[model samples]
Target chain A: IIGMMAMTLSSVAADHLPSWNEGATKRAIIEFVENVTEEGSPGFVPPSERIAVFDNDGTLWSEAPLPFQAAFAFDEVKRRVPTEPALAADPMVKAMLDGDIGKLLEGKHHDGLMRILALTHAGMTTDEFDRRVNQWAESASHPRFKRPYLELTYQPMQELLDYLRSHQFECFIVSGGGADFMRVWSERVYEIPPQNVVGSTAQVRYEMRDGKPVLIKTLDQLFVDDKEGKPVGIHQFIGRRPIACFGNSDGDQAMLEYTTIGNPHPSFGLIVHHTDAEREYAYDEKPPASGKLTTALEAAAARGWTVVDMKRDWNQIWSNPDAASN
Target chain B: IIGMMAMTLSSVAADHLPSWNEGATKRAIIEFVENVTEEGSPGFVPPSERIAVFDNDGTLWSEAPLPFQAAFAFDEVKRRVPTEPALAADPMVKAMLDGDIGKLLEGKHHDGLMRILALTHAGMTTDEFDRRVNQWAESASHPRFKRPYLELTYQPMQELLDYLRSHQFECFIVSGGGADFMRVWSERVYEIPPQNVVGSTAQVRYEMRDGKPVLIKTLDQLFVDDKEGKPVGIHQFIGRRPIACFGNSDGDQAMLEYTTIGNPHPSFGLIVHHTDAEREYAYDEKPPASGKLTTALEAAAARGWTVVDMKRDWNQIWSNPDAASN
Candidate 1:
């Protein structure tokens, strides 16, 4: 009896995903990892080819209340308006200052919101922009969680990153967020380097400023890495099709299709359904912020993609800061 | 006396750059590597921050008689013309077939040759293009060297790559060549992976063809990553300033400047001055094909960038296939 009890305790201690509940979603992740990692298995993928991509906002962290980037942009507009009074002249800036998200996202392509982003995100040197992002990341907090915004990254997903890395998988963040914004804190928060973050990019021109080289960020050519652009960004930056993809919204539909459809290697696609309204805001078609999820969620079952009910599958959402386990 | 001789032999064997002669250029490279890697040194850089970028084409391998990509493109035209004779009607195609090199490079931007590239390089699925590039790489040989074009990679530079990598520096190829073209053989030839090769890119559209995901290449949004574009590409792809830069032409000048000028980290910039007409093609203002060096060459002395005169700096041009050293 004692021996059996000892074995059970040891097995539980060995669990890589302690935050994940014992369910179909967890089992599927484990099964796929094993299938591809087993050397002689027909589904085996080499270490060099073990690429995994994850969406940022709703997938890795709470995108509710406001997409963190939008929040940052809005805050930026408010802060800069005092110094640069002309910034208030733009309706997008006025909308942002008024916290009018619906007005910002009125157009199908979100032209108003895009213009606001260009105002807040561009027209500075790359170094200066990087410094501003770092400053924001240091002081910003989630309005609801009241914790630092960077602390809101989901615990289960962080475990998944570590779990995948244990098997030599190179995990990348392929998000709809601004690349520069994510790259600022990605290395510290996710342990994923700047080069591994694929997101929307603005044109940066090379210049010689006062006898020194500088890269000036401009709004000239903006590449929005969302929906269809996800797959395109993956190819442009990563140059290889990922075998694993994780996401939450319609934005990731194309990426999921690109990862699993007719992939030569065994592929895994997982969708993080924000199903915990109490613990974390839950919505499918409509949400408090961006990340509308109807299309991807509807297609998940037909494609054999694992759908994780955030409330049911995850025992804990955010990582415990006190946990000794690395 | 025998013991002393063995010690001398072992000292010679310990040298990483067998192809490089004892010179100021070699000494500077060794000194920079030591300064950045030594733990207690003021110039020491963390392993993760040690990024070294090199140019492709004439910098890495021979681009003589005809640049390898041009040779491949011309061959591609010849091969496809029989099946699709419409390709022959284009003036660029006619110039290529006639070996009228002057007519092909008539425009300042090489617009004629670019059109030929778009025709040969696009309108195909990316996977099909990869297969074609692989096939070409397997069969292609250098016209002057009478060896596989891949084998024409400079031994000294290859040694330099290995040497830098040994000190934990992650090396990337920032080139004017096509990213898709170089990605096919970069990993095998230069030990730089596809993600590490930043270069010119044509637009790739993602589509579902017969229920299988495919990326189609197009000539739209053609990004010619040369001169100023190199720095922009590095920022977009690598997302940080590189500490070391290597190049052989004016096209690489901006990249070199972006790497070394006022960089936070201690930096090294090098230029390979081709002066060996017997063993390798030698040109500065004029060359067999492309890679003009006038601007960069004149700037090198004032900038304190090391310039390697191929005849004086290198003992060998190409790597010996039979060498035991990695």
Candidate 2:
């Protein structure tokens, strides 16, 4: 009995974390956690004072050619094209349907993609849109990876999130994707439920439908969840400055800037630079699709943000043990 | 040298928070940490999975008689009343000026309060309003407590926030007060900075003035942050469901409900019940300015939410230990 109890306690302690691979990322993470959590450590942050924010797309998961939501949108458009045969020939719709994601985004600025999103996503009820997104996510596979898009999530990132939470870090997903679309699977995938996800949204209208009140989407623009809008989104949604923030694109610059501003104790701001082409496609300055990552890199380096070199830091790419098995 | 080494090691272990008061609250908290953190724990949650949300008004501080912002409004109105003497003769204004908070709220519901808030808070430029709120907050004292209104914040709650944070909990303040107003001081009081505070607000218009664009508030109603609105606000702002929630009124019931709904793991909801009549005024099921405790109490009991009896559980009240001392 004594031996069993000892083993159980040791196992519990050992299981708290399999030791992290040694490197700057591990050191940074451990140092940050220790400073914030260890009471007498120079960086000892009180629990009430602990606040960490994360970007949803590239930082948390994969935002390769496009954000996962954009990919979902493309899949959705493809599925719905049969219902609207004219979309088969429509250049914009054709590009999406044919999976010519790069072509659809070719030479288009961020505003152009927003315009496409507005046209593609607007006029549908929030519920209908959510249902379509769920259906696509369930069935769709990434063209390059040949894995379900959800499986494309970065493994090391997942470990980091779990690590932070264990220490009392409140994590949040600040993204430029549609809030409704992200909310559906975030809880299951990231363990972040719908209420903790902040993203871009169209204005919603509260109306009576058959004597029942429902919040429906409208064509009117509410707020974009990118670039300068990121700070505003954090202000409007989370309502508190994050002591720590993580992101992978220029869109997250404002959020990182805002997070680091005037924080009294030690704070952290990390940028996940996609430097791995084999495990994951590597591109920066310009994304493969409509996503851009210029301003954040410039600001990150100047501001001393921790730029994560994926090729160097991570031994594992995705969470599936199958990746290693293969 | 050996004794000193032992002392240092003991201090390190002691600093790990093993000495927190032993009980359900401590156990629940520690168990949650272990589950989310300890890889072998049945509830072992990953780092990507750690997202926590908190209610601001009563959970983080005190919202007795009226919310802190409401008190700020009252004081602002009283200060400005001298500039508008003609309005001082008005019954509502007279009641406000006389410090008859009860009479001012007599027969007035939430709509009535909104009307007063609109009339008093709107029309002013955003900067003007913010300055006034800050000025009032700096000077105003609670009627009964006679402490700077902000100083009325509960110390134990602050400790709780720190405790959770030390464990890596991401804390936020979701309140029914104005977002801007709360943002001003929430950072200083709760250590939850401006970006994490979500609340009600008047519509803001973005425009250029003196060659620079600024967002200005309009009298138009934007959003309410109470009752059903709490959940809506959470959806619009935080965008993810919280694992833990805390509140003290009906306004927070929806938030708690939303937080616990369909959550599989051990989620927590806590209601701070003001039961001390001598140290703090106590009333439940009363109307108009009476602190909201009735619906919350029943719902909490039914849902197995933790109901904190202030008189019994708390060894201390308010951050200012010298208030009663003085």
Residue B154's lDDT within candidate 2 is: 75
What tens digits encode model 1's per-residue C-alpha lDDT throughout B1-326? 65575455335433888889987898888878877876666799999889999998888888887778878888788888888868878778888889887787788888878888988799999999999888887787777787877788898998999888988999999998889998888888888888888988866899999998999998777777899999999988889789999999999999999998899999999999999999998898998778899999999988878999999999999967532122
Give model 2's share of reference contacts: 0.27
Tens-digit lDDT track of model 1 for A121-146: 88899889889877887787888888
Would you list the C-alpha lDDT of every candidate in the order shown?
A: 0.86, 0.68
TM-score of each: 0.94, 0.62
**Stretches of candidate 1 above 4 Å error?**
A1-14, A322-326, B1-14, B107-109, B322-326
Q: Tens-digit lDDT track for model 2 on A258-286?
A: 67655566888999888888988787876
TM-score between candidate 2 and the true structure:
0.62
Where is model 2 more than 4 Å wrong at Cα? A1-21, A84-116, A119-128, A207-213, A219-221, A299-301, A321-326, B1-139, B142-175, B183-197, B201-222, B226-231, B238-326
Superposition error at A315 for model 1 (Å): 1.3
CAPRI-style grade of the A/B interface in model 1: medium
Residue pairs clashing in model 1 are: none
Q: What is the interface RMSD of candidate 1, in Å?
A: 0.9
